[model samples]
Every structure is written in C-alpha cells, then in structure tokens.
Target chain A: MIEFKAAAVTAPDSGVSILEPTTLTLTEERISIIGANGSGKSTLARLINGLVLPITGTVEVDGLDTVKQGAKVRRKVGYLFTDPTSQLIMPTAVEDVTLSLRRIIDDKSERTEAALTALEEIGLGGKGDVSVNALSGGQRQLLALAGVLAVTPEVIVADEPTTLLDLRWRAHVGALLRTLPLQVIEVTHDLDAASRAHRTIVIDSGAVAFDGDPAEAVKFYRDLMFGRPTRTADA
Target chain B: MISLLGIYRPGTTPLHKASAGLKSLMLLLTVIVTMMVDDPVTSVGIMCACLLLLVSTAPPAKATLRAMGIIMVVAVLTVSFQLWRGEVERAIDVAADLTAIAALALAISCSTPMESMLDLVSRMVRPFGRILPPETIGLMFALTLRAIPEAARIFIDARTAARARGLERDPRAVLIPGATRTVGFALQLGQALHARGIAEEAKPERTEKKPRRDRRSEKAAAKEHAAAQATADAETSETPLVTYSTTKPANDVAGPTTAPEGNTSAS
Candidate 1:
C-alpha cells in the first residue's frame, strides 16, 4: 500500500534533482528497483523508510504520511544499507538484534532471550556473544538482517545488500531475503536478483524508464544501462 | 604503526598464570601504595619491585623499552625539574615514583589480556545496580581504548590526503574533515550499540525489579544469574576468538609518498 505521488527528491547541498517527478504504487509483495550508480535507485528505496524525504510531492506508507509520521513509518519500514559494517552498530551480534527489541521487551533477561531466539532463527545462534567486527562479510550481513528482522517491521527495504559479498554469500543473502514474509523492496544492480522479484522497475536520470514484469523490465534496464539503442520494448 | 590489544606471547611464566583479575587488583594496590608513600626509599623499593615483576613476565626487552620510553622521558623530566628547583633528594624521589608507576602500568599491558581486563572491570562494577550496566561500560571502555589508536591513524591519513591536495595550509583541511570523520565514527559506534540491544533505558528496569526480592535471595539470585550468564558466554566463546591481527602480510606493499608542500607565501 506504499505510494509515492509525484515524488521528486533532490540533494540538499547541490540542489541537484536525483529523482524526477514520478507517481507509483507498490502493492506487490516483492518489488526490485534496478539502476546504475547515481541512477537514484537507492534514493527511491530510502524514501520508503523515510531515510530520505522528497523535496516535492508526497510519500505515504500504508496511508501514513512519511514526512509527518517519519518515526512511525520507520518502525514499519526497516532498512538494510549496502554496508553491514556501517549498519551494524553493536559490538556483538546478539547485542545488535537485542537492540531492536528495546521498544518491545524492557526487561534485560527477556530482551536477551528474544535476541538469542532471533539469532538462532538466522543460523547464528552460536555467535550470539562474538564481536561483530570479527565476523566475515557474509555473517555480518546475516547478522544485520537478524537485527532488522527482530524489529518485526511490516516492510523491509534493502539497498544493494549483497554488493560486497562473494558469490556464495551473495546467493545466500539473496535467498534469505527472498524467504522473508514481509513486503520486500530491494535496490540492486544484480540482474539475477532483479529477475527473482515479482515486479521490476528501471530508473534512470531520477525517473522510471520501465515498469513491468521482471523479464521485460530487466531487458529494458540492460539496454538502458549499457547505452544500447532503444529497443521496441522500451518504446 | 599498528598494534593489537591482546595476542598471547609464548610464555609459561608465573605472571602469565596469575588470574587477570588478581593481577589487575595487585597492580591497583601497588599504584595506590606508591602514591601514599612519601619516603624516597619506599618509592625506590616499589620501582625495583615493579621492574622485577615486569622482568619475570619475560616480554621482549625491546618491546618493554619501546613501550616504556614515554614514562622514562617523564621520569627524567621530573628529575630535571626537581634538581632545577634545588631539591636533589626530592628529584630522586619523584624519578623513583614515576618509574614505579610506569613499571606497574607496563606489567598490566604485558600480562593481562584485554578481554579479561574488560571482564574484570565489569565484575568490579556489577554492584552499582543498573546506574551503569557493567558490561556496557566495559564495552565502551574497550571501544574507547581500541578507537584511540584508530582515530589517530585516520587523522594522519586525512591529513596526508589534504596535504596531497595542496590544502595543507588551510585550517579547514586538517580540522573540518577530521572532525567530520570522527563524528561519523561516533555515529557508527552509536549504531553498533543500537544493533547490540544495549540502550540507556534498559538499566532502570533492573533497579525497578530489585525491591521485590529479599536481600539474601537477591544476592543468591544475582550469583546464580552471573553463573548462568558465564556458562552461556563460555559456550559461545569456545571457539578461538578472532583477534584483529596487526601483522601485515607480504604481498600488499605500497611506496611512501611525501605530503605536498604548502604555500605560506599566499598571505
């Protein structure tokens, strides 16, 4: 039910528009946004979680206005940034997930139990007390997912969550994301990842260049991304 | 200059065998005693004892000397200052006091693992009852200790980058970006704390729950809770915890480039 009505986002300092006026409704359970770097894909994903606000127009999450209800909207929309290292704020894996439940379980013992359960769910049970800095890239990303998942948000927004990972870890993270029950919105450059989504949107120069089924959208995106001549499908 | 906090050196000395908490306690006691004693002989005696203790630990002499160089400089300066003020005996006492303090500090650095030190501090502060969760404080102290060197390294790198861009003379080059990077680091740390589930609000809940229990049961409960927590922690820590290895591998080598020369003539 997330909707963006004529949304236009611009960089505050440069006053350079990154996302052009666009109206779109995200009603599907899972949607992937694909674009090159500086193509404003991340900005669009961030808007869902109120990490970035539109300079013009309105963004609403399930009828809640993002600008006025940012805190509540953030609670519903969990964000996973590209860098797990940057996103993981806690010293240990268990502690990080436990932090998300701070609003829910006030008791230290209860909070610890809940956090441990969340970690166990993610296959990181044995690493509850291990320092976050020591984990491998893949493990950290999974830990980051566990942190976001513990919050029990309605919508999960990830920005290139697998970009830094190796092939195995990348697939592992992708599969993990695919399995989540919540509404998923992922911004990625990975064509395979985009193909797995139910719907795909191609963004270029801060505007939607293509929006349709994954296969057609990917094809449109590929041509647009590589600067190939406009195909009949694009038109 | 990269140096990690705790990588075990190959040693089977008595100092190594002593419990980290006991060792820390002994060091604290010795430092306190040194501060109290005004007599030159007692100060000198404590200094000698500290040196003997450090030697018994059997770390590399070069490492010890290099590490203690700053303390030695301080001791020399104290001696010189006292002598300049025409107090020869006082100078000797001050020098001996500085040496003792330095020796005890070095013993701490050499014998105790950083994790154990953190654990000891947490245990010592546990009775404070949620005014500060000892574990969170321990983590903060560990992070602050770890970040000091890291922050210095970043500052140096930033300064070098600014110099290379020929902005060395501009105060903004050194100050603004350094502050920005440090703030970014602090934000990352705050985020990490959030991820771990340790918030400032959780502390008061433990205190609120304290009043219902009888004093004896509370003590027993605390003990049981600590033991269970320890057991749970031990199971997770069974694997050899990865240390941030400071050693550089052979392949990744880069040439040292000088910072760009600044233009002071612009004024």
Candidate 2:
C-alpha cells in the first residue's frame, strides 16, 4: 500500500505548489489517475515512488518512508516513463534487461539467462540481441516494461506510458498492465483505459477533484476538462 | 559517425572469434606500430592488411564502405595539406598512417560484439574498483554507445521541423531545440536510473573508504551486503515474467528510424 500524509510538492524555482496538501492511501490493485496535461497527476504518481518528494508532509510505500528509505521505496516501486527511448540505457534489448538485473544477479551468465527469460516472457524472445534502436516504438515500450519487471518490483507507477504509442499498441499495453498481478497506479489521458481501472482518481488544477468509481471519475474528468459543471456525474 | 560505433556482426572468422581484450590490444599495437614507422610503404602495407582483415569479416557492405569513405576523405584532406606545404613524402606517410589506424579501429569494432567490449572495459577498470565502480564505468560506456544514435535522431528531427517552418537556414532554430531536448532526455534518463535503482545500493561503498568507518561498522556493512545478496537470491526464484500474446507481427512497416548502418543486427 502507498500512503500520502498531507503530501504536497512545490516547484523548486518558483515555490508554487504543484500538488496541494493531499492525503490519500492507494491500495487498489489497478488504480488510474486522469487529469489535464498539467493537473499534477504525474506529480501524484511520482510521489508514490519518491521521484518527487513532498515539501509539506510524507509519502510512504508499504510503511517505508519515501524520503528516508528512498532507495528501498524505489526498489519496490518501478517507474515507467512515457518514452521508452529515454528509459532504455543499453544498446541491445537483452543487455538493457541484464542491466536491471545487475543489482539482483551477480553472476554474468545467470544474469544473461534471467534477462533472456524476461525478454521471452515479454514477447521479445527472438529480438533479444537486436539493437534497441532497431525495435519498433511498440516493441521498445514492451522492452522497457520487461526491464522494470526483471527487478520484480512490487508496485508499478507508470506515467502516461502509452501516450506515445499508437492505438493498437496502447490497447495491447493497457491490457497487459491491467492483467499484471502487482499493484499498478497509472497516470494517463486515455479515458477508456482509465475507466477500466478498479478505481480512478481525477485531478483538477493540482487537487483531487474526484475519487470514486472508475466510470464516475472518468465522467468527472471529462466534465472538468470540457469546462462543464463537474456535477454531471451526480445529475 | 554513430555507425562507426557499436556495429558488430557475429561470425566464426578468426577476428570474430578472438577475445575482445585481444582484439583491443591488437588494435592498439597496430596503431602504435603504424605511428613508429614514418615510411610510406610500411604504412600502406599496414593499411592494406587492416582493410583485408576488415573485409574478411564481411560486415555490412554499405556501412563499411561509408566508414571507409569517411576515412578516405580525411586522408585526402591531410595529404593535400601536407602537399601544399611542399612535403610530398610526408603527405603520403601521414595519409597512409591515418588510414591504417582508422581501418584497424573499425575492424576491431566490427569483429567484437559490444557486450564483450563492454565486459573488457569493466575488466580493465576492476583494478580501480575502490575509486570507481567498474560496473558504473561500464554502464557509462554502454550509455554512450546507446546515446549516439538517439542524439543523431534528435538532431534530424529538429532540422526537419525547422525546415518545415522555413527556418532551415537559421542555426538557432535547430540548435536551441536540440540542446534543450537533449538536456530533457538526459534528465529523464537520470530519473530512469534512480527509479531502476541499478547502482544505488553499491554507491555508498565507494565513499565508505574515505570516511574510514570503524571495524565494527565495516563488519556491519559486510553483514548488510550479505543480507542484500541473500534477499536478491530469494527474489530470483520468482521470475516476475509478465507474458502477453499479440495478434499481428510486431515489426513496424516503417522499419528502423535510425540509418541502415545503425541496425547492425546479426543477420
């Protein structure tokens, strides 16, 4: 479980609050956060993993304080970025996965074997040795996911992971994320995907505008973005 | 330039089979030998041998030729500069030596897979493990190989966007965006590293030597390391594999966005 106790983030330069003093506990297996481009949804997702530390209060993952036990919290919470190109640091697919395994597996050949197995599991078996640059955008995203999974992170916090993918890839990756057994908290603009989550949180102008059933949260997000009264869900 | 790096092809040729460390040493020796000799004939002979070795590996023809073309262009410029100075023999010697070294470097890169080369780099740095983490240094080298093509793509995209806006001739249009985007990409990469927690655990050990912790604390640290390793072993039993099935071939019709020379996939 991830907990935010009056946690809020402020922009370092301007001292403007990026997230309002928000206190919430995220325990659902599949939770989606939807908001406008700059509504602080990404900030909220990042707080779960200590990527963005709160200036006001504290954020904790499974009782481990994100600020104090940051490395440990980060180990438990894997982050997936919008663009896999930036996330993939190695030349080849297998090499990239092996890099993630470095902290876990010390033996060279055993690490390679684990990485290859990860690639196989992610449907990139034959392309393990291929240059990461050569893989299609979709495959690259999948490979990035594979690297994150190789660490066996307990929670996955994805920040608009499918934003750069096509419709087909978005659906494929979305379904894949939903099926994963671990807790997944995703920040996305895809309303349909947001609606599929077990719970949805809607952020509007750096505050949680709505938090409830997925369908209702999606409706609230739509109303807020389209400049309509957010009471449409109630109406 | 990106193609000049990380372009390895798997093969059974003697050069391919040679250990990356041996190949790297040979490359260094060949360059040193070439530099020690100012005779045009010997340099030319070395250059020919390097070319023979490179072609025997049968690397991608287009990419190899492109690299050779670049080497030839540089050689010509150097030779012409020497000729302009009324040093004809010096021109021949300098051009031949330059070609020989460049060809030899390319040959080594083509024959040795990048993973092996990275391993060789880490092994080389193992002696200085206290001061610098061998794994981190290896990661830095791998990141360089990975970033070159990405940087090239960013430049091309920036230029294309500038051209579409009728600002192709304006250097600032491309340079400004390219610089900012590269910085942004680098920041994202750092975040990725932190999130992945690759080297975070071992980071403090490098600094522990400077602080000179007490023997008891050192023992405690050793115990912590062992516990971490034990936890890692326990976790390895759970593969953490997330499997999925796709409907169609995942291959993109647009092919790789990078240049053909950048592919270098074992064929």
Candidate 2, B1-267: lDDT as tens digits: 576565676678999888989988888898788878888888888889988898878777777789889888998999999999999988988888888787778787778766677788889999999998887888788877877777787889999999999999999999999988888887888888888887787654221113223455445545555555556766776532221111222222222334245432111
| Model 1 steric clash pairs | A89-B191, A89-B192, A89-B193, A90-B192, A95-B196, A95-B197, A96-B195, A96-B196, A98-B197, A99-B197
- Per-residue lDDT tens digits of candidate 1, residues A144-214? 99988887889999889999999999999999999999999999989999988999988888888888799
Error of 1 at B199 (Å): 7.9
- Of the true interface contacts, each candidate retains a share of 0.06, 0.49
Residues A142-233, candidate 2: write the lDDT tens digits: 99999999999999999999999998999889988998889999999999989999999998788888888999888777778788875733
Worst 10 residues of 2 chain A by lDDT: A226-235
Query: Can you give the TM-score per candidate against the true fold?
Result: 0.60, 0.82
Tell me how each candidate scores on DockQ against the true complex: 0.05, 0.20
Flag regions of model 2 displaced more than 4 Å.
A232-235, B81-92, B204-267
Model 1, C-alpha of A156: deviation from truth (Å): 1.3
